[model samples]
Target chain A: MTLPAHGLPAGTLRRVRIVGTGLLGASIGMALTRQGIDVELSDSSPTAQALARDLGAGRLAEDGDDAAAPELVVVAVPPDVTARVIADQLHAYPTATVTDIASVKGRILDQVRALVEPRTLDRYIGSHPMAGRERSGAIAARADLFAGRPWVICTDEDTPAKDLQHVVDLARLVGGTPVHLDADRHDAAVARISHAPQVMSSLMAARLKDAPMDAVALAGQGLRDVTRIAASDPALWAQILDANAVEVRNVLTELREDLDTVIGALDGRVDALGVLASAIGAGNEGQARIPGKHGTAPTVYSTVTVLVGDKPGELGRLFTEMGEAGINLEDLQLEHANGQQFGLAEVSVLPAARGPLIEELRARGWTVPE
Target chain B: MTLPAHGLPAGTLRRVRIVGTGLLGASIGMALTRQGIDVELSDSSPTAQALARDLGAGRLAEDGDDAAAPELVVVAVPPDVTARVIADQLHAYPTATVTDIASVKGRILDQVRALVEPRTLDRYIGSHPMAGRERSGAIAARADLFAGRPWVICTDEDTPAKDLQHVVDLARLVGGTPVHLDADRHDAAVARISHAPQVMSSLMAARLKDAPMDAVALAGQGLRDVTRIAASDPALWAQILDANAVEVRNVLTELREDLDTVIGALDGRVDALGVLASAIGAGNEGQARIPGKHGTAPTVYSTVTVLVGDKPGELGRLFTEMGEAGINLEDLQLEHANGQQFGLAEVSVLPAARGPLIEELRARGWTVPE
Candidate 1:
């Protein structure tokens, strides 16, 4: 029996089969199931499939052996196995549209193309939802993980519009905004934005490997923010970086040049200050190029830092007051003093809301510090 | 007239003078004046001093021209000018304990030691309150700037106990936890943790100077976090880097070796994966070494990522519910999806509260995603 559409047209995607029950796969299944669509789960590891099933991501494929063929098959295996799984699934589910959610797209697409016939290729598209956490495994999966995140849909020149549409629908069904990008452009984009930062963060944190505890103790928000993502699973990261090595290498080579110049300046070059200043100035421009916190467009929000008492509910009361004032807190951070009894909640709101939020908080007898 | 100690003894610090009216200077003056202590402000820039005075940081030194010698004198100037200012203030306020708030301690302390006689040296202590913002100037200053932040106080062998105590009192008066570190150790610690990250962030962002716009549009939270501090003022950073050059250079050199190894692996050595994996894994260990969010001690907080609706008071309501459940929200980040209606509020709380918090949230009909 066909079910109502999760997001795509009715009957077009009544059932989805996920070939791997890892973080991304189970997450996709959970999201689709939450939308009232049927999802089937399988994994090379039976234990993992049981875990994903227990997590309510989907039913085990074994439990649905006699069920009709899935309308869609998602190959969510690791990059090395992704092509093999896609080929196997494409043959196994002739009527299903196939897609894979791998971080690196171009190489995987190339591999799948070599393994499949042109007709089989027509039913396949590659998509990547740009969402992840430091943790991994089925236990860490979430239904709304892809919500409001960007999902890149890579299409071949000969890809049918309808097939592309199906992949885009899957992305949207999970609450992602699908952006059309060619495989090459997608790889290059991730290499610049994702891979390079991972390398730099890893390298930067590597210096702290044997650092004195006291030295590490002085870590502030700046250092913390820059190195937060350095805690990602290393083996997984190595594979992702390996797949996107060429593009990452290109960026790293250029970054090394800048590093060398900084070293030269530090070695007491006559024009060291000028070199150092320009390096830092370019950084200012680069950082400004990033989209604002909300990710829609560029914005410069003003922060209204308020005194937050250590007592329970003080923060809650402050947020409640802000909410009642019709102010939306775009972001907030709590900075408690090293050994102090109170802390500051630096609340970032829309620039226009800054004055009103602060004025209202103070009017309500709260200490709205700068 | 003696005033009740603003967390310090009364007559011991009846009046304070700040010799610079920049962000840190103005913030200190404002916090002191708010506690009912007499504060005097001065700056080479008359406009700055006037603005700081108008902002209630303190009265202009003119108002205190005939006042008794300040019981305490603070020198808050640029790194290059720190030694000169400290020497000038020490001679100007012989009865007052003289201290300078500079980021790099060893170099400035050496300069001061060379400039001052033995008695003058006994009155001088170098301090650094590990609190700063990307912005500068008196306008950006806040009275609570140092609250809950670590303040490093460096003392000389000949420094009298009372003089050291007064400097410690200054740190506490502004709501900071005073930690004593020799100038050498303090400089080395900041060089490894702070200066090196600044250089790395700037160098990484520098590579984006000529990058395609489309690539930059793919920037995510990871890239933004790694480069957030790159927006700092270049000229000021260059000066700071110059003062801590030797130690910073040492760390950079070690980091460069790691970079070379990473590049070698990316070039496809047979042992590439192991090398790359080790680098990334070392990062995992290093990142864990950092103290928790507030810098007080190491803490392992579990994050509960809740699906927050876009409605104005949704966050407030959620926080209020959390407060009612007796969960102290330690830290938080709100990530809004691009063009999406809902956001994720990743709330950090005590690990013990994770299960209860999630159970309560789900029972209250909120979606607490993994």
Candidate 2:
């Protein structure tokens, strides 16, 4: 087998076993196998394991093969069955460093703690690689799925350093940046940033179900952004929201309090406008705190909107012009109006570059309106 | 002045007057002036009006100049003072067709009805152009701001056809697609499609205000989208929410009901998973119904993600290659991972083009994992 051009150095992980051949499992297997690590794949469904093996994720595992013992075991399964499968893996591979990639960590840790002995638990590390695609299953596996994503590794005071290092090395080998956090903190963080946002997006989109067609026709970019994730798989979200119910509920409860305040103000409170203003102002403050690209502090970029025909090669020409002008695009959004034959390409650049870029585009006969 | 390349056909509107030179008013002025229409500008702030005039939006209006009588008058004032200004302009220009571009139509219509005679009100048509910019005032105005956007015209049964036609002509002249709806219906539609989404976005973002930095650090694209519009102007949004309080509150109250149900299910209610699943399922259905770009039925596009280095002209090179391949991009989203040196450019195209495009991109030495 050919080694990946950027494969992990020698003396790293020699062999790994992934216990489920689903999307995450197959993807992890593919990444490790590409790095020249010996990866064995297994699944509850023989067809799935065979599919993953055929896709070059890894070789099919043979039961009772002590000669092929893995240096590490990765448990990738459904959340409801994750702890059980992790416990079984720990029992089956007593010498291997064990880890599970579960989105919600605290509850899984508690469940695993109850199912396994303390000594076995010392070898287990809980991690969550924050990467996924809308599609699932082995057919959707990718070797770079975890590339450039955060992989949260959960540990406590009792966790062994050697075992933790093995998991961290695996994360890096798969092209993920390892972040350390305790199980409880990781759960809280995911709930606040991911879980709560999903619930809110779904809730907002649900209101449009019975809305009049003309009303929905009036929908714009704001509505589109707020509800985009609502198209996520309901069964999976139900599992995730159920697992992190408490933290998700806490956030929703506080959001409801803010909603009530706005509702009450709109219902004609004494200082109605003040309450309304503060609600939106607080949002401004919070939104400004979200880190910008490359995890840097939020930087405000100046946007220049240029009109382009709705056809192929138009955007390429516009972006090529910007490139010729040596202005790097900080962000871009293409807005199409209802029944319009053209779109507005809102190109954001550094504040200092805005004037020159606009002048250059206008000189090149592109429409950059004042 | 030289005639615009695509000036409106002769004998449409000879002279028009605009009150309040904020973003909307100034943009309207600029568009008309570019179309070779005689636009007269006036604002409560002389500085704003002068800025708009100097920027070629229009010539400044002189008070009580009979020689400069306009064929139309557009009152583009703040929502709170919109009706008063509309009524005053209608009385001041007895022969001109007067219209106001207020986001909330019903309240302004009610107030104008209470203040003016039926004959006077017949000449006052309320129109709302669903277009805006993040920055306000004359400096941010663009001649093409309303191009290819929806311009809602609110008219009652008693309204004269002559005045309605004038507003429709103006909408077309400025490149807007005019949509006909009564005052109350227009208000309700905006409340559902625009105002309510803003309130929900702000409420979601407000929850992040006091969150731990670590928790906020875990923010992803989903969180960014749900709270993107939360960075909107508070004072402006407050006025909008207060103007359409009833409809906005109605939508929010129903959303709160769904939130309560989800909260109840998460509280360990019997069949909790069913409740949660249906909640997300309803969102999927509703989100599916939102019209795609160009106001057509939602069309699902297949996305191909390619790794792009974070630098100037990297995107230009990528798009230039796609252009060479002759594939039209239906949509594009750039995702940057925290602390990563590269970003993923998710290029969406027709399902028929996905395989060929991926092969083409991969052959060009771009990293496209499968």
**Quick one: best lDDT, which candidate?**
2
Query: Candidate 1 residues B1-370, lDDT tens each?
Result: 4456556445356678899999999999888888777888999999999999988888888654645778688999889999998998888777789888889999998898899997788888899999888899999999999887788999757779888877887888887778889999999999889999999998887766777786776677888889989999999999898898888889989988888888888888757778888989999888888787556467888899999887667888888899899988887777777666678889888999999999999999998876
The prediction achieving the highest DockQ against the true structure is 2
| lDDT per residue as tens, model 2, B1-370 | 5353355555347688999999999999998887788899999998999999998889998766997588799999899999999889989999889999988988988999999998888899999998886678888898888887889998878878778878888898888889998988888889988898898888888888998887787777888888999999999889999999999999999998999999999888757789999999999988998888876467788999898887777887888888899988888888886777778889899999999999999999999877
Model 2: residues with Cα > 4 Å off, grouped in runs = A1-11, B1-7
Question: What TM-score, computed on C-alpha atoms, does each candidate reach?
Answer: 0.95, 0.96
Candidate 2's residue-wise lDDT over A195-293, tens digit each? Answer: 888888888898889888888888788899999999998888899888888888888889989999999998997577889999999999888888776
Q: Which stretches of candidate 1 lie over 4 Å from their true place?
A: A1-11, A62-67, B1-11, B63-67, B293-295
Lowest-scoring 10 consecutive residues by lDDT in candidate 1 chain B?
B2-11
- Number of colliding residue pairs in each model: 3, 0
